[model samples]
Target: MTLTLVTGGTGHLGRDIVDRLVGDGHHVRLLARSPGARPDVEWAVGDLATGVGLSDALQDVDTVINAATYSPIARRGGVRPVDFFRSPSAVDVEGTERLLSLCQRQSIRHFLHVSIVGLDDATLPYARVKLAGERLVRASALSWSVVRAMPFYYLLDKMITSFAWLPLWPMPTTSFNPVDTSDVADHIVACAFDGIFGERTEIGGPQDISIAELGGQYRDARGLHRKILPVPMSEAKARGMGFVISRGARGRLTWADWLQHRYSVTHQAA
Candidate 1:
């Protein structure tokens, strides 16, 4: 059996990848900072930030899917001025370097990196760090591929949910192609199986919708009617948030489709 190593296996996208891989009978090893009870997969306790237990995790691994990233600003729910300058060097940059070095030493067959779209046009400090990581993969001696994915719908759900209670919802006029995690996972798994090399792919949702429109859909799903205040931002800055997908594989789910399923489940449980 071919052993595959997955970094960030417990995350939103990572979990879906791991599940699909395991379901397909691929020998999967997950690199996680702490122990988890997800069944039918080997767990390697490791910290990407500290480079701890990475060597052990890379042992006998034929392929590596690096989905790990650190973003405190987004994870913590709000961005601060100080966070604007802070890059996720510890995990995304330095950790990628560490993993690639070990992959070379161990003669890993293929390396798959998960990234965000519009890094080149985006102005975010975090985008720069992730772009740097992609550069490392492209320049590495190991056979590598990069998959740039659009923002997930769950992320937008969180953003919209945060302000649903307000009398007026403030949203950027910028639009993005929000996708389902499962769709991105399916693409990653296919790439891994084919052992694709030197290829960069982008995946996004089926339609391009503005943030304000998405917010309105969310409010309607939850039965809330609130005024929408479109936040003014420069075109370049809005592009940094996410880009409209002119090309690449579009996901099967639309925002309205996802919203309907989301609230339908909630309503059923209630």
Candidate 2:
């Protein structure tokens, strides 16, 4: 069985990927900052920022999936925080560079880096960093695939809520090709073992939906009367709020704004 080492194995997406890898009969090793009990998989204590536990984490591993991400960005009052970019870069970019270097030394076969769609034009610092991280992977000699994914349904639920205890959603006018996290995990597994290599692929949901439409669907799903507000806010405002929110919220919303504005004109034409 192929031994796969997954960074950020405890995260929502990472856990799903690990679960699939384990179910497929592959030996999975998880690199995490904390030492916790994960009965199903082997856990290696490692901190990406300090380069701790990296070598041991990569030992005997065949492939590495960089699934690490910071907490959401949230506002305290109105000021956008700097921790949003700082923390992500520390873990996402610098930590990724270290991992890639290790992979190069170990002759790891495949390196799959997870990224968000429309990273090229994303104004948020997180996207910019992610874009930079992608470039770093491309520069490496190790076989690599940069998988860019659209927003997930879970993300929508986490981002908004309704008064009837339902999930109210807010979407930009820009279009989204939301893909299930499971689909993304499946695609990653495919790329890990059996697919074209050294190419970037954009993965999204089967159907494209606007932010407003997505919000409406969530409202309908819960059978709530909450209005799906399509606030015509500028990209700047959206991005600004992204920076000010919780670290986890920051990355997701920043990318959301970036995707919306980057595809706004194209979506309009379609």
| Index of the highest-lDDT prediction | 1
Question: lDDT tens digits, residues 94-209, model 2?
Answer: 88899899889999988998877766556667667777888888899999887777656556555544223533434566555665677778877777787567755566666655
Give TM per candidate.
0.93, 0.77
Give the range of the ten consecutive residues with the poorest summed lDDT in model 2: 243-252
lDDT of all predictions, in order shown? Answer: 0.85, 0.68
RMSD in order of candidates: 2.2, 9.3
Worst 10 residues of 1 by lDDT: 261-270
Model 2 TM-score is 0.77
